[model samples]
Target: MAIKTWELDSNFKNEIAAMPGGEGIMKCFQCSTCTVGCPITELEPSYNPRKIIQMSLLGMKKEVLESEEIWLCAVCQTCSERCPQDVRISDLMGAIRRIAEKEAEEGKIELKGVRAIFEKAFMHQLEKFGRMYEIGLSMEYYKKAHGGFFAGMMAMQKDYQKLGMRFFKKGKMGPKSMFPDKIKRTGEVKKIFEKVGE
Candidate 1:
């Protein structure tokens, strides 16, 4: 395969470098530790964490920024754990996600299906109960992603019962309520996000 070199704008490099975990791209040696440690790469070759860093270093911002593959990363932390250079692969991906999310906010990007559904469910939970109710959020997310009853029928047979039990259990609480003090702290965090227009 011929390696493609993108002609990226200098401002893009500066933009990415200013991100929290994006500053170490220039120091990478292509050791491939991040690649080898990423579990998702085993199933999806397009998600090479090391290659992501290389693309970032080369300032292929468009390709990197427009990717749904970055969203597929579940942040399992294996890549970060195995990185010999101590590069925070999860954090770098988070920085990239912020860039993509900013573009999404500007209407330049449109998230499809699961991503949009997930986002809506997440925000709904935050706005309604001040934290995520995992079971409730999951059901809402599934319904939104599947588009209605017919699409989720098969999945429901396998997982819905379990999730419903969790959701309706008398003693269950949302993630925030599980820790009394953390709820207050999370409210403070939400205030900070609101201040930043998040």
Candidate 2:
């Protein structure tokens, strides 16, 4: 990929530091501790939280916000726990996620592919039902991800059938879960979401 010219916006690091989980980002000094401890790196060699942080610090706004790698973070705190500088790499990832979502929402950039849809669908399900509806989230995300409900269903048919059979045999799959279940204090849950503006 061609590198984008860095713009005059050198405030990315400071902006991230001001975010809720990003306070420790400024203390990093190219230490590799975070990368060495991040389990995601073992699974996906292309994803390195350290590299992502360096990109943000270097003011690579477009690359930082648009790369699917940012969304790949599992939010496991291994990186933060292992960091010698206490940069809180997981928290920095959260800050980057917030910025990316904001940029997409504001039309500063277009979010292509399934990651954005999946995140929104997951959040919507969580907010509405106060819990995860796996089937519902899958349906919603795949519909948007595949650009059509039918395509999504077709693609996920086998996996759904397999999991469905397993759950049914184990007596775990039930109609109640297929339907969205609201907790006793769903209102309170909604309020919490409102407070967080999620």
Best by TM-score: 2
Query: How does each model score on TM-score?
Result: 0.71, 0.90
CA RMSD (A), model 1: 4.8
Worst 10 residues of 1 by lDDT: 176-185
Q: lDDT tens string, model 1, 1-86?
A: 34465466446656766889867556678899988867799998877888877777777766777777778778888887887777
lDDT per residue (tens digit) for residues 1-198 in model 2 = 555655635798888999999898878898788888778899998988888888888888877888888888888789888888988888888888888889999989765446778888999888888988888899998888887989999877855889888898888987766787766777888898899886
- Candidate 2's clash total is 0
The C-alpha stretches of model 2 lying farther than 4 A from their native spots are 1-8
Best-fitting candidate, scored by lDDT: 2
Q: Would you list the C-alpha lDDT of every candidate in the order shown?
A: 0.70, 0.83
